[model samples]
Target: MPSVLKTQPWNVHRLPAAEGKRFLVTGGNAGIGYFVAEQLAGTGATVVLGSRDAAKAEAAIASIRSRVPGAKVQHLRLDLADLASLKTSVDALGPDRLDAVVYNAGVALDHPPRRETKDGHELMFATNHLGHFALTGWLAPLLVATPGSRIITTGSFAAKSERLDFDDLQNTHDYRPKRTYGRSKLAQMLFSFELDRRLRAAGSTTLSVVVHPGGALDSLTPSRPQVRVRTTGERLRGLPLGLLVQGKEAGAWPAVRAVLDPDVRGGHLWGPRVFGLRGRPGLAPIWDHLADTTTAARLWAASCDLTGVAPTFTPV
Candidate 1:
């Protein structure tokens, strides 16, 4: 039987089929990242799954191949917490053009205390925001070459209560893990929106968009032996939470919309339709922080200074 939901607005299948297109998805080894790759690759896009783990990345490739028979998928060695790894991935994409890049990889929910990246920054800030800021800057040349190519930064509901802390970019003092994570996500939204503004000012054709997956849980994500193996506790909590929360497959829709929807304008946020949590994808209402251009510019300036990469986008 044909799926019933396709007729409804926000159906994942409604997105046009993609062929001869290439996409890069960071953190594609697991969770919503993996599902985003799967959905895009299933439509015949060459999906590069980027993660720090070679073995797990290969496993994700295998999973995509299995589920989407003839899926064009590949592995990209990427460590969100490291810059050398970004260099490696950039070299891999040398001269190869991409249709879009989804900055979906991030550290979330669990970690050691006061931990930092090899670059000597807070792990959450370094991994979630800094790494993507660097990656986007590095890829600006390639992104500009492709017509209508987009850079999609994943935002979070956590950003609602967060504010920029310029005095402490690393979040070293009074650092609560959850709040720190939230602030990093806030940084992402700020960066994407600011990027679109700069692209416009510079007359660049590369688009920048932000989408947030509300409360997507890895526990509800299915187990893939080499990629993501759910724990017994995750299985227990996942099944119950699955009732109220979305699995990774459902969680990926908003991002897919941002990538494939020609009508979607840059700088507008997209989220799940119902309460920004669990439901079909829809246009997200703007929050006060989202509209604050001053704050967005501040965060963008800080990112460039900290990452030490200046992106020069020549107008198309």
Candidate 2:
């Protein structure tokens, strides 16, 4: 191997077939999650898709199979918006070993009239951060048991300017949809990095990585009738998509690299190389504000308290 390879991440061109490995993805029914599952399946890995919609999950599986003949794919119904549903989904997964997990499901856009989930959490907060928090806790044992396993959590550029609103985590008082969404993504990054730190402190082998699929727009994403159904507005938006935003297929590269890149270490955060919004995946910079141990610990404690899911690691 070259000397540089030992110090830097590798660019993925031809992913070595991951035969006998097992991977799971959240929101695998559509968009970037569907693409993530598809690419992993293409590499000979058995994939379990966690989705809320059965029909959509089935369609995604069918779509994967069409491209990769005899792809080993299964669906586990997981509702990221519901804590009970998340618990049920984890129970269905059993205590089996998994090679990796991609926390790909998230609410990327702002919703009108902010609402709370059945768990009484802000809708975006619940689905984007809370659900993943609980799910990871439920599956931590299996993850730690499997040597070299990795966890990749998706984040966003909007998080670059976000600071967690601990006082109003649910945005109950000043409920701005876009700001709430940004905080949620920031929370994911905080959780993932803290998880990595804890894993290392406990001398665990499993790694936690954070990545963002920069600007994955609906107009640029592939049209799959069974999975993604773009409307008239979305079609119209496609006219200018090529000029700015890259396709979702390209967008998924950062995440895929985060999971399978041999050079990635625990706590590593990766994103696009150019403008932090487009081009090939690379190790990008993150705001130093996110590195505050005090804030991270506070968020970690609050997450456990709210979701009732405790991590399996101890502090160093």
Model 1 TM-score? Answer: 0.91
Worst lDDT run of 10 residues, candidate 1, spans 1-10
Error of 2 at 154 (Å): 0.1
Q: Count the backbone clashes (under 3 Å) in each candidate.
A: 0, 0
Could you tell me how far off, in angstroms, the CA of residue 238 lies in candidate 1 after the best superposition?
4.3
- Report the lDDT tens digits of candidate 2 across residue range 140-201: 87787788999999988888898987888878987788898999999999999898888988
- Let me know the TM-score candidate 2 reaches against the reference structure: 0.92
Error of 1 at 142 (Å): 0.6
Clashing residue pairs, candidate 1? none
Q: State residue 102's C-alpha deviation in candidate 2, in Å.
A: 0.5
lDDT of model 1 at residue 211?
A: 89
In candidate 2, what residue range of length 10 has the lowest lDDT sum? 1-10
lDDT of each: 0.82, 0.83
